[model samples]
Structures are given as structure tokens and as C-alpha cells.
Target: MRDVAVISFSQLLVDKAEANDAELVMPVVREALGRAGLQKQDIGFTCSGSSDFLTGMPFSFVGALDAVGPWPPIEESHVEMDGAWALYEAWVRLQHGDIDTALVYAFGRSTLGPIEDILALQLDPYYEAPMWPDATSLAALQARALLDSGRLSDSDKKKATAEPPKIVDGAAAVVLASGDRARKLCSRPAFISGIDHRIESHLLGVRDLSHSVSTEIAAKHAGCFEKSPTFAELHAPYSAQELILCDALKLDKQVTINPSGGAQNNNAVMVAGLIRIGEAATRVSNREADCALAHASSGPCLQQNLICMLEARA
Candidate 1:
């Protein structure tokens, strides 16, 4: 694989975005490109992540393309998932050896509707969706199972209860480049040394709620266990999920988790996971740490997880 690196990252998080998605994406996209010393034309590929369900508009991601200036026309794509997954696609595109750089972004406003209610629709229609259990309640079930398993002490449970995830409306963008192009874009690049994503069985009843086998498998594939990370930006919307992820990744107390305050401080539905990756990349770019792990999850109770291992070029 050709070396790919996150050259620049930018994000905006607020209680509510007063403008439309296109308006919201423009600033972050511009800022990210500027930070990397690149113009829109300099980007070889562009990909975005957003959900039509959030806006209740079909092809909502299409409108956001205006912010990227498709004037001269650019090779681009979109994912119905988070921006982190878009970055994953961009990384793969760079490996084709035809593209030297790519732009990735995500924008959404969960405040437009009942975020939890919308999330419930993703559950199994026959078994789980009919019950209409919101995200927190489903996560609570996972927490109860974890507690019952005797995996967490009473103190851990209390700690988990204290830090509930904060929901916000926002957008984020990242610039990626291959090898020499990456070094030219930024003095310090957060090279994507390893990246892998995995998903568990969709049925909640069949999976082990107490352990995140999918996360473990992804982490192993991403070389997360090969070298210690100085920090980790985990997209755990709930403290219980954070606890679960920490245990799955086997992070030690010495590793500072969520220095950017994680999703607990500010989370924007489709944008939060990408922000986790951007946050970790920013740290690596700033030389705050040599190695870091950024995680993004989708589906209720962390059914899908992606592990990104980033490191400074040696």
C-alpha cells in the first residue's frame, strides 16, 4: 500500500447550526484544505459522508458538494455512514497509485429531529425495531449485561454513569495525501499506518454485549496491539461503550484517552466519528504524540467499529 497520511483536519461543533448543510460544510472544508496548503483543484479525489435520514431529504449529500466547488468537476463519492468511513475509502483510492491526494468530509444536524428516535430505525425490523428502543436504552441493556458479567467494578459503573455523551450539530473535514505528496502538504503528517473496520452480527441477542469482539478483531488487524498509542479518540457515544472499547483495545492507564474530550464533550451524529479521527490526526500532526488510535462506530450498541492506527513518519 502506498503510504497515506492525514495532512490536515478541521471541525465545527455547536448546539445547532443556524445554516444549511452546504453552508455548514464550506468553512471546515476550506479550513482543512488551507491548512494543508492545497486548493480544491489540487485534490485528486473527494469523498463525503452524511445521512439522508438526518435531514429527511433524499441525496442530502449532493447539496453539500456545492461547498467543495465541483465547478471544474472532481472525482468524488459519498458514504451513507460517518466521515471516518469516507476517509477509509479515500485511503483505498490513494492506493490505486493514480491519485495523490483526497478530500474527506461529513456534515449533519441531529438537532433537526429526535436523534434517538431516528437511530432506532436501524435496528432489526422484525425483532428490535418494532420495539422502538432508543439508542441510550439499547446501550443501557449492554451496560447491564457488562455489569452482570462482573467485568467492571462498582467504581467503574459509577464512572460510566458520570460521563454521558454530548450531542451537537457540526461538520468536519480532512485532507489526505500519498507519500511524497503528504510530506509536501504538511511538515508533520499523521500517516495511516494501519486501518481496518469490522462489524458484529446485527442481532443484539446473539452477540456478547459484555465484550466487543468486533473491535478487538479490527484492532488486531489494524496493528493497534503492535505498538502502544499515546492517546485514543474513541467514538463511544455512551460511557458504557467507552468502557467496553477500552477493555476491547486493552489500553493501559498510561495512554491518555480522549484528550479532545471525545464524544462525551461534543458529538455530531454523522460527523462525530470523523471528528474522532481528525482529532487524533491533529495531535499527530502537532507532534503531541508519536502514535495514536482513532475509533468510529455505527449501529446500536457498537455493532460496527473501525480502528485507525496513525503514526508519525519515521
Candidate 2:
């Protein structure tokens, strides 16, 4: 595999927005490209993450392609998962050694529809989807399990149960370059030391909601436990889930958690996980952290997880 680093990242989040998906995505794409001192054509490959279900239209991501200006015809692909998975795909593409640089972006307008109902569609159609359980209710089931599992203290439980999630509109863009290409793009780059993702059984009842086995496996494969991370950007949509991730990752109080206030501050659906990665990269690029961990998740109640470890070298 080739050495790859996060050269530039940009993000925007709003409680409510009137702009279309393409309109919202364009600015961040421009910002990331501009920060990397590159133009659209300079990007060797491009990938994006978004959901047509949220947009209530098919090929909604195709329309967002205009945001990247595919007029000259650029190599691109889209994932129905979070933008973090898009970054994962770009990382793999870069490893092929055919591309020196790639652009990854994700956008979502959760305000467009009933987020709870839309997210419920992600559950098993035969068992869970038919029941039409909302996102919070499902999460609450997990939270209740964790509380009763004897894994958390009274204060931790109180902190976990504080408030509900607030869905927002958001988008994020990241520029990745390999080896020498990375050095030319930025003075300091957050080199991707390792990255991996894992998933668990889809059936909520059969899985252990109190613990994130997938996160532990992904983090181990990503080499996150090789050294203590100074910071962690976890894509926990709820406070209880954040606690679950902390335990799974084995993070201590000395480690900074969610300096960006996490998803609870701005839950942007598909975009939040990518924002976590961008936030961690920014810390490394700025020399605030020598090593950091960024995590993203898909599926209900933390059924799927991706962990990426980053390091800054002088």
C-alpha cells in the first residue's frame, strides 16, 4: 500500500438550510481544493457518500456531481453510506498506486424529510423496518441495555441520557494525496497510519448493545491501540453511544473527546462521520496532536464502525 495523508478538509453544518444539495456541497469542495492548492482537474479520482432515500429521489447523488464539475468527465463513484466510507474507498483507490491525489466529499440535508422515519428504513425490513421504530427509540433500547449492563457509573449514565439528537444540514470535503504529493500540498499532513472497518449482526436483539465489538475489531485492525491517541473524533450520534465508543476504544480521561462538540452539537446524518475524520485530520495538520483516532459508523445502534489512525511526523 502507498502512503496517503489528509491534505485538506472543509465542512459546514446548519440547523436549517434552504440550499440544494449541490449548492451546499460546492463550497466545501472548493474550500478543500483551494486549501490543497489544486484545481478540479488536478484531482486524479473522486468519490462521494450520500443517500437517495433521504432525498426522496433516485440518483440524487448524480445531481450533486455538478458540485464537483464533472463536465470534462472525471473518475467518480458514490456510496449510499456515510462520507467516511467514501473516504475509505478513496484511501483504497489511492493504494492502487495509480492515483496521486483524490477528493472525497459527502452531503446531507436531514431537514428535507422525517429523519427518524427515513433512518428506520436502514433496519432489517422483515423484522425491524415493519415495526417502524424511530431512530431515537432504537437508540434508547441500546442505551437502556448499557445502563443495565453495569458498565457505566451513575454520572456516566446521567451524562449519556442528557438530551436527544438534533438533525441538521451539513456537508464535508477532504483532499487526500500520497507520499510526495502530500508534502507538496501542505506543510503538515495528517498521514493515515492505518484504517479499517467492521460490522456486526444486523439483528439488534441478538447483538450486545452495551458494547461495540465491531469498534474494537476495527480499531485493532486500524492499529489505533498500538499507541494511545491524544484525541478521538467519534461519530456517535447520541451521548450514550459516545460512552459506548469510549469504552470500546479504551480511551482515557486524558484524551480529548469531541473538541468539535460532536454530533450532538450538529447531527448532519451522512455528513457527521466525515466531519469527525476532518476534525481529527485538522488537529494533526495544525500540530495540535501527534496522533489521533477518527471513527465513523453505519447501521442502527452502532452495528457498523470504521476507525482510522493518523499521525504527524516532523
Candidate 3:
């Protein structure tokens, strides 16, 4: 397999943003490209992640292309899911051997609408969506199950200190390069040693919410169990979910989890996952961590999960 590494990353998070999506993405994209010592036209491919549900407008991501300088026309793709998926797509594109570099970004303004209501739409239309259970409520169900299962004691739960996720507007971008180009772009590129994603049964009733089986499967496929990472950036919006992820990945106390505060600090829907990845990449790029684990998730009750193992080049 061709080696792919994250060369540069940039992000912005705020309680709310007065600027539109394109405006929110422009500066971060510029910063990421600039840090990689490249220009807009120099990019080989571009992919973004966002949702139209927040804006109540279809094809909302199309407008964000203004930030990537689409004037000269560039190869691009978009995912309705989180930006981490877009990064995955970019990594796959790099494996084609024709492209040496790619740009990946994601932006979301959860404050634009009732985020809980928007998230509830991800549930099954026939069963869950009709009931309109908010994201927090669903997460609470998982927490309750975990508590009852004896995995999370009152003290353990209290230690984690579950906090209501902050609904914020944010944008994050990362630059990816292949092999030698990665070395040229950044002194210590965060190479993607392994990455994979998995989804459990959509019917939340059949699956065990107390633990993330999907995360474990994804972690196993991503080689997360091969070696321990010094840092772990998990996209768990709830403290209980974080606990579940730590258990699923078998991370020990030595692993520093969410040094950037994770999604609970700033949950911007589609953007937060990419921010976790960017944070992990930045830690590796700066030599703060020799190996790192970055995780992203979507759907209700941690139904979908992605794990990316990053390591600093020798």
C-alpha cells in the first residue's frame, strides 16, 4: 500500500459564526494549504463533509466550494457524513498513485437549527425518527444501560463528569500527501498506518449500547490493537461514550485521551470528527506523540465508527 500522511491541519470553533459556510471554510483551507507550502491550484484532489439538514437547504455543501477556489476547476467530492469520512476518501484517492496530495475539510453550524432535532433525523424513519428522540436522550439511554451493566459505576461515571455537549459552529481542514511528498510538506508527517470504519445494525434495540461493538471492530480492522498509542483523540460527544470507546480500544491510563477536549467541548455535528483527526495529526506532526489514535462516529448511539492509527515517521 502507498504511504499517506497528514502534513498540515487547521481549524476554527466558535459558539456561533456570523459568516456563512464558505466564509467559515476559507480561512482554514487557506491556513492548511499555506502550512503545507502549497497553493489552491496545487492540490490534487479535494473532499468535504457537511450536511444540508442544519441549513434546511439542499446541496448546501456546494456553496462551500468557493473557499477551495473552484475557479480553475478541481477534482472534488463531498460526504453527507462527518469530515473524517472525507479524509478517508482522500486517503483512498492518494492510494491511486496518480495524486500526491489532497485536501479534506468539514464545516457545520449546529446553532443554525435545533441540533437535537436535526440529529434525531438520523434515526430510523419508521420507528425512531417518528418518535423524535433527541441525541442527548438516546445517549442517556446508553449511559443508563452502561450503568446498569456494572461497567460504569457511580464513581467512575462521576470521574468522567459527563457534560452537555456544546453546540458550536466550526470548520476544520487537513492536508494529505503521499510518501516523499508527505516528507517534503511537513518535517514529521503523521502517517496513516491503518484506517477503517464499521457500522452496527441500525436497529438500536438489537445492539448493545453499553459498549461500542462497531468501534471495536473498526479498531481491530484499523490495527489499533497492534500497539498502544500515546495520545487518543476520540469523537465521543458524551462522557459515557468516551468511556465506552476507551474500553473498546483497550486504551490504558498511559494514553492521553482528548487533550483538545474532544467533542463534548465543541460538538459541531459534521465538523467535530474531522477536528479530532486534525488534533491527532497536529500532535504527531509536532512530535508530541510518536503514535496516536483518532476516532470518529456518526448515527445514534454510536452506531457508526471509524478509527485511524497515526504514527510519526522515523
Candidate 4:
């Protein structure tokens, strides 16, 4: 596989975005490209992540494409999932050796609708959706299970409870390039050493709510535990979820967690996961950490997890 690195990253998070999805996305896209010293045409491929459910309209992502200026007709794709998955697709595309550079982005406006009720629709339509359990309640079930498992200390539970949840509006973008192309775009690139993603059983009843088996599997596959990370950017929307991820990833006390204040402090639906990756990449590029582990999750209570390990060139 060819060496790929994240050369540039940019994000915008706020209580609410006054602009539309396209308007909110354009600035971050421009900033990411500008930082990489590239333009729209310079990007060989573009991938985005967003959800039509949040927009309460079909093909909402299509409107956001205008922000990227498909005019010259750039190759592009969109994922209904988070932007971290879009980044994953871009990484795979770059591996084909045809494209040296790609642009990945995600955006979300939680204020568009009743976000909790919308997320409830993601559950099993027959078994769970009929019950209409909101996202927070679903997550609380997992948290209660974890607390009952005796995996976390009382202090951990208390700490988690103390942090209030903050869901914001945001957009994030990242520029990726391979080998020589990556080296040319930035003085320091956060080279992707390993990356993997895994998912748990969709039925919450069948899975172990206390532990993230999927996260552990992905982290193992991504070589996250081969060496302790200086820090981790975990896409944990709740404090309790952070504890669960830390345990699953086997991070030590020495590792700093959530230097960006995490999703609990500034959760932005689909955008938060991509921001985790961008935050970790920035740390690597800035030489704040020789190596970092970034994580993203989708579904209720960490049902799907993606882990990425990044290292700065020696």
C-alpha cells in the first residue's frame, strides 16, 4: 500500500450556523485547501459525509456539493454516514495509485429538527423504532450497563456525570495526499500508519453494553495499542462513552484524552467524528505528539467504531 498522510485540516463549530449546509461547508473546504496550498482543481477526488435525515430532505448532500464547485466536473462521492467514513473512502481511493490528493469533508446542523427523535429512527424499525427511544436514553442504557459491570470506578462515573452534553453545528474538512505529493504539500504530514473500522450487533440486547468489542477489534487491527498514544481524539458524545472507549482502546493514564474538549463539549452530529480525526492529525502535524490515535463512532451507544493510528515522519 502507498503511504498516505493528512496534510491539512480545518473545522468550524458553533451553537448554531446562520448559513445553509452549503454555506457552512464552503469556508472550511476553502480553508483546508488553502492550508494545503491547493485549489479545488488541485484535488483529484472529493468525498463528503452527511445525513439527509438531519436535513429533513432527500439528497441534502447534493446541495453541499456546490460548495466544492463540481463545475470543472471533479470526481466525487458521498456517504450517508459520518465524514470519518468519507475520509476512509478517500484513503482507499488514494491507495489505487491514480489519485495523489483528495478532499474529505462533513457537515451537520443539529438545530434543523428534533435531533433525538430523528436518531431514534436509526434503531431496528420493527423491534426498537416502535418504542421511540431517543438517542440520550439509548446511550444512558449503555452507561448504566457499564456502571453495573464494575469496569469503571465511582470517580469515573462521577466525572462523566459532571460533564454536560453539548451538541453544536459544524463542518470539517481534510486534505489527503500520498508519498511525495504529501511531502510537497506540507512540511509535516500525519502519515497514516494503520486504520480499521468494525461494528457491533445492531440489536442492543444481543451485545455487551459495558465493553466495546468492536472498538477493541478495530484498535487491534489498526495497531493502536502497539504503542501508547500521546493523546486520543475520541468521538465520544458523552462522558461515560469516553470511559468505555478508553477501556476498549487500552489507553494508559499517561495518554491525554480529548484535548479538543471532545464531542461532549462540542458535539456536531456527523461533523464530530471527522473533527476527531482532524484534531488528531493537527497534533501530529504540529509535532505535539509523535503518534496519535483517532476514533469515530456511529449508531447508538458506540455501535460502530473506526480507529486510526497516525505518526509523524522521523
Candidate 5:
């Protein structure tokens, strides 16, 4: 492996932030680059995760590129997926010897519409579209399935915690580097130890929503906890899904789950995943834990999942 690492990260809240999307992204990008001890010109490439649906227009991300100053031109791509996948793309690019540093980011504003209704677009528009079901209903279905399995009590299947998610609208950015460049940027870089994303079938009705088989599959491939993860941050939009994920990761009662609150507290679609990874990295950076598991999800009822293990070195 190329030993890529996250050197710096930044975030802005979703609903509470007053700035427009482009305005929100610029400072975040600047903060990330500033922490990396480099300027925009130093970045090897840039990748972002965002959905056009959220903005009600195509190429919405193209406007975001302006936040970074495109006069000079830079390598970049945008995914219809979440920022978590965008980070994955940058990680993959680092596999080659030529690239040393890159930037990844995501942004979402749920207040623009009934997010559940908007998310319906991710479905196949064929058989699934006819139902016109929103994410909440599908997650409820998953909640019911878990209850039926007798795996958890009704209370355990509730929303994450009393603490509200940081629901304000926001954006987040991170800079990554490999080899010597990584060492030069930070004294303790949160290395991209293992990263993987998996997607379940689009038809919510066909799959077993009760469990995160995708997470389990991702964990195995993602080389979980080099040591036991003392902390874990999972994207569970509902209370029930939190219980399901804990079971899927076999997280045991010992791990600190979502001290950063999680999606239930506040969520912006594109950046939420980046926030999860950032939370995990922060724990490692602060010397609170040697390793941590950060998970991000997309699609209805956790149809897609990404597991990233971040490790800190002495």
C-alpha cells in the first residue's frame, strides 16, 4: 500500500450556517489546506462528493470548484455519491506513485426540501419508484424487521441518543498525502489504514434491512481495528439503526460510540460521511485512542456503507 494519510480536516454546519453553498465550501477548503501547511497550488488533485438533487440543479459541484479558485485549473471529479466515497477515490489515486497529496470534501443542505422525499430519487425509478416511499418509511421497515428478528428490544431500536445531531447545514474538507509528503505535513498523521465501501440492492423491499450486512462485508475487507477501536462513529439516522450497526460491527459495550453525536443530532447529506471519518481521526489525533472505526452510509435504510479505520502512531 502507498501509506496515504489524512493530514487536515474542517467542517461547517448545515441548517444553521447562513452562507450559500459556494460560500460555505471556500473557507472549509481553505482551513483544510491551511492546516496541511500548503496552498491550493500544492494539492495534487481534488475530489468532492455531492448530489445535484439537493440543489435542484445539475453540476452544482461545478460552482463549488469556484470556491477553490479554478483559474489555474486542477484535477477534480464529483460523485453523485456522498463525500465518504469521494475520499475513497482520492485514496485510490494515491495508490499510484505519482500523486502525493489531494483534497476531498462534501456538502449537503437538507432544509432545501423534505430530504426523505428527495432521497427517493436514488431508487431505480422503475418498480421502486411506483411506491413513492420516502426514507423514513423504509427505515421504519428496517426497524420493524429488526424487531421481528428478536435481536433487540424496542428501546434499543430507538434514535441514537438524547443529544441532538448537529443538524445545521454545513460542508467539510480534508487534505491527504502519502510517503514523505505526509510526514512533512503533520507530526502525527491519521493514516488511511483501510477503506472500503459496499452497496446493497437499490430495491429496499428485497433486502434484509434489519442488519448491516454491507457493513459486516466492508469491515472484513477494510482490515478493521489494527488494535481494538476504543471509539467508533457510525452514521445511524434513526435510533434503531444505531443498535443494528453496533450488532453488525460487534462493537461490544466497551467502545465509545458517536461522542460527536451522529446524524440523528444533525446531518447534511454529502458531508456527513466526511464528518464520521473526521471524528475518528480527531480521536486518534488527540491521543484519546490508538485506533477507531468510522462508518458512513448512503441510500435508504443504510443501503450503502463505508468503513474506514484511522490509526495514530506515537
Candidate 6:
């Protein structure tokens, strides 16, 4: 496999609750294109991640495409998943050698519904769905398990929840390239050094609530989770899950966590996981982070997770 680098990134503020989806995403998309020294048409491909259930309307991504402009139908695709998954597809397409670089992004207004109940749809239909365990309640079950295990203190968990959960509405985008193409585009390219993702059983009660199997598997697939010098940006929807994942990955004090304040600080539904990846890439592009780990979660209690390692090369 070849290396791909995220060359640029842009994000809309979390506070823009009034703007519709198109208005929220346009600025971030243009800003990312501008930073990458390209125009919309110059992009070889485009992909996005978002969920229709959040807005009670399907094809939310189609409206998002209106931001790119008329006709000729640019090569693009959309995922009913997190933006990180869209990024994953973009990376895979780049591997085929036909595409040099691609743009990936996502937007959402999480406040549209009672987050807990809304997320229950991701659970199993037969058994778990009937119980109607909400997102927070499922997360709380994980938190309670962690506290019971003595892996984390209630005080330590407070670090992530010190502020109100960022029940936000916004969008994030990133541009990526390979080798020389990346070098020519930016003084420093935040190489997508490594990435991997996996899924666990969907039943929240069936899985070990205190651990993330997906995280463990993804770290191994990425090939440096055990011995690497990098800060980690994790999409821990709740503070306790962050602690549990840290233990599963065995990340130590050497690894700085979530300088971006993470999703617990501000949640944007389906796209929040992908935004974590963008935040890490932005740090590398700006030269503030030499190497970093970006993590994302899906399903209740992090039943699915993705890990990407990024580095800046001049």
C-alpha cells in the first residue's frame, strides 16, 4: 500500500446553529480548497459522511453537493456513515492509482433530536432495539463499568466532562495527496501515515461494555499503536469511553489527548468522528504536531472504531 497525506483542512465554528446544512458546509469546503491551492473543479474526487436520520430527511448529502456548483457532475459519492468512513473510501480510491488526491468532509446538526433516543436506531432490531437504550444511557453503562473496574477514577473522568457537552452544529473538510503531489501543494503535507477500522458485535449488552475491541484491532492494523510518539485525538462521545479506549490501546502519559477538546466538548452527530481526524490533520499541517493519532467511533458504546496515524513531512 502507498502513503496518502492530508494536505489541508478547514472547519466551521460549532456555534452556527442557524445556518442550514449547505450554508454550514460551503465555507469549510471553500476554505479547505483554498488552503490546498485548488478550485472545486480541480478536485479529482469528492466524498462525504453524514446521516439522514439526524435531520429526518434522507439525501442530506445531495444538498451539501450544491456547494460545489453546476453541471458535469463531479466524481463524488456519499456515505450514510461518519465522515471518517468517507475519508477511508477516498484513501482506498487513491490506492487504485487513478486518483492523486481527494476531498472528504461531513456536516450535522445533532441538536435536532433527543440524541440518546435518536441513536437507538443503530442498535439491533430484535432484542436491543425493543429495550430502547439511548446513546447516553448506553454510554453511561460503559462509564459505570469503567468506574467499577477501577481503571479510571470518577475524578479523572471529569477532565473530559469539565465543560458541557458541545451539542453543536457544524461541518469539517480535508484535502489529501500522495508524495510529490502533496509536496508541491503545501510546504508540509500531513501524511496519512497509517489507518485502520473494525467493528464489534452490535448488541451493547453482549459486548464487554468496558472495552473496545475495534480500537484494539485497528491499532494493530495501523502498526505503531504500541511504540509511537504521537498525540491522540479520540472521538469519545462520552468522557468515560475515552478512558476505557485509552486503556485498551495502552496509550500512556507520553501521548497527549484531545488538544482540540474532542467530541465530548462538542458533538456533531455522524460527522463528529471524521472531524476528529480533520483536527489531527490540521495540527500536522500547521507544524504544531509532528505525528498524531486520530480516532473515531460508531455504533453504541464504540462498537466500531477507526484509527489513523498522521505525520508531517517537508
Which candidate number maximizes lDDT? 2
| Candidate 6 vs. true structure, TM-score | 0.94
Q: Candidate 4 lDDT, tens digit per residue, 1-314?
A: 79999999999998988999999999999999999999999999999999999888999999999999898798999999999999999999999998899999999998788888889999999989999998888888887888888767768877544243687889999999999999989999999988999998889999988899999999999888786689899999877889999999988899999999989889899999999999999999999999999999999989999998988985
User: Could you tell me the lDDT of residue 177 within candidate 6?
Assistant: 83
* Tens digit of per-residue lDDT, candidate 6, span 1-314: 87788988888756547877888888988999999998887778889988888777978888878877735777899988889989998998888877788999898888777767878888878877788877777777777776666656657756433223567887889898877888999887878877899999876667888788889999889864654646788999788788877877888888888988888878887778888888888787777878888898888888889998888765
**Residue range 180-221, candidate 5, lDDT tens digits:** 788789888888789988888887667888888899899878
Q: Model 1, 12-76: lDDT tens per residue? A: 99898898999999999999999999999999999999999999899999999999989888899
Task: Compose the digit string of candidate 2's lDDT tens values, residues 149-256.
Answer: 997887898966625688899999999999999998899999999999999999998998999999999999999888777899999888999999999999999999
Model 4 poorest ten-residue lDDT run: 157-166
Error of 3 at 141 (Å): 0.1
TM-score for predicted model 5 compared with the true structure? 0.94
lDDT of 1: 0.91
What is the C-alpha lDDT profile of model 3 across 175-202, one tens digit per residue? 9999999998799999999999999998
For candidate 3, the per-residue lDDT at 41 reads 86
Q: List the residue pairs that clash in candidate 3.
A: none
RMSD to the true structure for each prediction, in A, is 1.1, 0.9, 1.1, 1.1, 2.1, 2.0
Query: How does candidate 3 score on lDDT?
Result: 0.91
Off by over 4 Å in 3: 159-162
- Predict model 2's lDDT versus the native: 0.92
